[model samples]
Target chain A: MIMEKLKLNIKIFFEGAYLSYVGLFRWLSPSTYLATLIFSPLTQMLFFVLIGTYAQGTDKAYFYVIGNALMNAAMSGIYGVTMSIGGDRWDGTLPYLFGAPANRMTVFLGRAFMHILNGMIGVLTGLLWGWLLFHIDYSAANPWALLLTILVTTFSTSGLGLLMGCIGLITRNVMFVNNTVYFVLLVFSGANLDLATLPSWMRIVSNYLPLTRGIASARLIIAGHSLTEVLPLLIEEFGIGLFFALLGYSLFRWFEITAKKRGTLEVF
Target chain B: MSAIEVINLQREFQTTIGVFNRKKKIVPAVKGISFEIAGGELFGLLGPNGAGKTTSVKMLTTLLIPTGGTAKILGLDIVNDAEAVRPRIGFIFGGERGLYWRLNATDNLRYFASLYYLDPAVSKKRIPYLLEMVGLTDRADEKVEGYSRGMRQRLHIARALLHDPEVLFLDEPTMGLDPVGARELRQTVRNLQDEKKTILLTTHYMFEADALCQRVAVINKGEIVAMDTPSKLKDSVNDLSVVEIEVFGIPPETVEKIKTLSMVENVSVEDRDQLQLLLVHTSKGAEAIPLLISELNGLKLGKVTTREPTLEDAYVRLVGGE
Candidate 1:
């Protein structure tokens, strides 16, 4: 019986994940998809890379490349996952969702599952852009360690997305909040500036965030460092990601109860 | 056991007025209204716009937490056993909005079926059956955005029945459909009744309630004014007759003047394009018609006739023709 329940939960998780992701892009033409998931991120990366290389010199292009590449995870995790969750309210499907008998945890977390994968793809795509445009060297990198770093980073960022998605449930200004947080991560995740040159307080702030360790770990892995050398950072990054995901899940549950109580499940 | 039961159920919304020093006002939407439905009975809650019909339905469906009282669906308390209650009941708010517009009808059903935790094996068989049941089998693969309002409404029905819920709450299911579409939808509803599904349908159309419901509760201002079988409710106006006087451009003061007539019990107007239909309920019957025409002195008049009171006259009389 327990096995059957678990199997059913797993099925709900994946099916919800896939369907919601498909729902998010239902209006997208091939051009829109390319513009959103590909060209938009690519152009943003190029702008930041150009500014970084111009200020620090050409040799430091790898630093900017790795930093901006990982930002793609935040891009997908924050914007994509939030949209998947918030879409229920905008599309008037929230009531049916709330009315369903499905496990709340499964349905809530399933929202982030597809975005995690999408974020991973987005990060990988950014890295590909890095290689094609700037000739960044991946020859010395441990492929497995880098892959692990990307997964952790995307997972952590998606956790933040889940939290923002819950906030979207109550507030009409969700897109404004999403844009602000994305830019905040860009500044504070050490995506652009060198951590050492920054003030001590900013460095302290970076340590508590998701991508700080993941980005540092990715840089180390690419410079031919063994996985063991950066094992502590990877562990911390994974923990941070887990923390946000759980926190988001909690907020999601709270929002559901509160909306039902306040009779605002589909108010917006 | 009753398929659905309610006791003094209520819901109040708190809204703030004004920007500076905003004052919170508690507005009661469903004011402690109560009713029950027997298993396998087709029940209707008849009310006008803003009559708390939707709010009452929302609370019973576990979509809104009541401010007072309690409700049970299939013996499960709506508030406490909401999780268990959800699987046993389905609801359609009756519009194009509840569906995933981007998805094909088939995908929409599959997704909702997962939300209801239906086994894949069951949903696979059930989706096609429901699509056929609602007469959307041919358009099952088309995106809902491409569907007409009626088709979308049909898909809404299909989605709600994906789990084969024992009780269905349909709020204004045919609100915006054309006559033929509404008839088709009503037919589908009747078929569901034939299948022994307990249905609680809320609508403002009295004829609809008369034609479809075994029992209906006439609600106004968040309270049920009367609850009984449609025929019994209509029988409340049996001594009365409805004189529908078709007039062109009747003034508001003239309507108020006619309401003052000793023979008029209640007066309500229906706007039919260029003409206004004056539906006057009175025990005087045809005798009241000449008095009404005399009051309408200068207005251009059309077909003026008296007919037997219907469920609508009963409704207009009970609610005082708002």
Candidate 2:
């Protein structure tokens, strides 16, 4: 019986994840997906890399490349996952979702599952863009370690996305909130700037955020550092991601109860 | 056991009144209304636009929590045991909004079926059967965005029945459909009733309630004014006559003046294209017609006829033509 239940849950998780992702993007033409998942991020990366190389010289291009490459995870995690969750309300599926007998945790967490994978792809695309454009050296990097760092980073970023998605339930201006958070992470997650150059307060804020340690750890691993050398940062990055995901889940549950109590489940 | 039960259920919303000096006001949407449905009965809730019909349905479906009182679905408390109640009940709030328009009908059903925790084996069989039941089998693979209003509404019915829920809540299922579409949907609803699925339907069409429901509750201002079978509710207006005055551009004050006559029980206006049909319900049959015409002396009157009262007359009288 227990095995059956677990199997059912696992099925629900993957099916839900796939369906939601497909539901969200199926309307877009292939070119729109290319623009959103590929070209847009590419241009943003190029803009920052050009600026960074201009300021610190072309030799430090690798630093900016790795930093901006990981930002793709944030893009997918924050924007893509958020849209998947918020789309329920905008598309008028919230009531049906709330009315369903599905486990809330399974459904809610499944929302980020596809985006996590997408985020990993986005990060890889960004790294590939860097390799093709700037000749960044991946010869010394451990391929496994780099993959693990990308997974953790994307997971952490998606955790934050889940939280923002819950906030989308009550507020009308969710896009505004999403844009503000994305730009804030760009500045604070050490994605485009050196952590040492940032002020004491900024460094402290970065320490608590999701992508900060992930970005730092990615830089170390790409520079040929062993897993043990960057293990502490990876652990902290994973912890931060887990923390945000749980916080988001708690908020998601709270929002559900509160919306039901306040009769605002479909208010917006 | 009753398939659905309610006791003094209520819901209130808080709205801010002013911009700078915002004062909060508690507005009651459902004022402790109560009713019940038998296991296999088709029940209708008839009301005006803001008559708390949707709010009441929302609460019973576990989409919204009630501020007071209690409800049960098949003996499960709607509040305390919502999760247990959810799988047993399915609801379709009418219109094009509830569906995932980008996905094909089959995908939409599959997704919602998973949400209801139906085994893959069951949904695979159930999805196609439901599509056929709603007459959408041929177009099951088409994106819902391309579907007509009737088709979307039918798909909604299919989605709701994916789990074979024992009870269904349909809020204005045919709100904006053409006559033929409405008839087909109503037929589908009747078929569901024949299968012993208890249904709670809320609609503005009196004829629909008369045609489909075994019982209906006329609700107004968040309260049920009357609850009985269609014929019984119609019987309440049996003595009254409905004087429908077709007039061109009748002034609003004239309608109010007609209401002042002691014989007029209630008055409501219906727009029939360019002409307005003023419906006056009164116990004084033909004798009250001249008095009603006198109030509209200057207006261009088309046709004034008196007919026996219908379930709509009872509704207009019960809701006081709000």
Candidate 3:
């Protein structure tokens, strides 16, 4: 049964990647990419890289680029699921998904896996764009550990996305919910700046945040750290992913039946 | 065996806020409503908004957990054996939500078909057949987002029937379609009856119920107010048979006088013009028409129309309302 579920999850991943416009629109229209992913984090990252070159030193150039890379992946992971799921909630699309024959776990995992697939595409774009424009070197000596970092990063980010998706389900305000929560997480994530320079309390908060530990782990990958060196961070990052996935899966399962009983699915 | 049976079934929903804000207030959407829907029967639940028709359907379809009552499909408890019931049922809500907008009609069917564990060969073969069944064969390849309201409705119906479940629950099957589309959808529903799929059709449309349902339960305010065949419901109203007329020149006083006729039970002026009126239960409409014209004293009837007891009249009479 578990094997079959895993197989079904793969299919759902492909379905979400191929079926969702957020996944397919870029391929179909080509022009949709620049407006969606480009101006979003890519443009901001470029501006920050240029600013870091003039204001700070050469060290800050890599700092600006690596921070953008982590932020891009994090944003992809969080928004990929939240907005997609939020889109469903805004239009009350989750009910249609919930109305399917599969149980809640199947539905949540399938969609979450799909978001991971889409998020990878976004990660690819951010990495490639960063490399091309700023001539940044993303190559690592231990490519395997770097890949592992990206995997755990993807998990942690998508996990946060799952939690955000659940909030979208309950709040039914996709834009406000996504923007408000994403902005708050982005702040503590210190996605825009170096967290080492913050006050003691702020640094403490950033380092201990649900995504911070995971962000540090992902950054270790881009900077080409050994797996043994970052194993503890990897464990924490993977754990956060599992936590959000389980949290999201359970909460979504609960809200699903409620939506049906309350008849909110039809009203919207 | 009964297709659907509910015995004192109850469902309570608590509105809860964020993670720590688990305080809840229970709302009873279904108040222990009990009834049986027989197999191969096209049944209907008719009500206005918030009537609990959808709630009852969801519970029966295993989409909801009952709070205090028990509902069974083919003798299986919905809550305990929900997965079992879902396979035996085909469900559809009247909206564009179910089908993936970016995907073509075939893709949507294939997705839902896979969801039901339909074999790949069968999935590929059934797509066209379901599309043909809903009369969207030519439009099958087009993205559902581009489909018109009626076409999208047709595709949604195709998606519903893809699994070929024994019992089909359709909630407001034709809420937004144009008259032509509604008529087409009603026809498709009638054809489903011919196929002997036990169907529970809920709609605010009295005419749709009258035309399609073998047994209809009129639900209002989360309670079953009336239930029976359309004809039986009409009979329950104590229908004396009324004369309906639309005239351009008839005056209000004349309408009042028409009510005073020996056979006339009540005269109701319907349209803005006093001329368009309905004369109820005075004389059998056929015999009363000439008499009404005679009483008119050359008021010269403009548009005279008559009809047997209609579902609206029946509903109004039974519910003590309109």
In model 2, what lDDT does residue B193 have?
A: 96
> Which residue segments of model 1 deviate by more than 4 Å?
A26-28
List candidate 2 segments past 4 Å from native: A25-28, B290-299
- For model 1, residues B122-171, the per-residue Cα lDDT tens digits are 99999999999999999999988899999999999999899999999999
If candidate 2 were superposed on the true structure by all CA atoms, what would the RMSD be? 1.7
Q: Which structure among the candidates has the greatest lDDT?
A: 2
Candidate 1 vs candidate 2: the TM-score winner is 1
List DockQ for all candidates: 0.82, 0.82, 0.41
Positional deviation of residue A223's Cα in model 3 after best superposition, in angstroms: 4.7
Q: What is the lDDT of residue A173 in candidate 1?
A: 94
Q: Estimate each model's TM-score.
A: 0.98, 0.96, 0.84
Q: Model 3 segments beyond 4 Å from truth? A: A1-13, A20-29, A138-141, A190-192, A210-224, A260-268, B9-32, B48-50, B66-68, B235-239, B247-301
Writing each residue's lDDT as its tens digit, candidate 3 over A1-268 gives: 8887666666554554445534223233556545655557788778778877888765556666656666655666676677566556554345446656654565565566655655556656666677788777767636677666666777777887878877777764655766766666566766556678777888876654455665566567667777798899889878878888888878777777666556555443
What tens digits encode model 2's per-residue C-alpha lDDT throughout A1-268?
8887788888889988998888864324788778877888899889999998999999988888888889989888988888888889899999999899888899999999999998899899999999999999898999999999999999999999998888887788987998998888999998898889999999999988999999999999989999889889989998998898899889888888888888878787
CA-based DockQ, model 3: 0.41
Top-scoring candidate (TM-score): 1
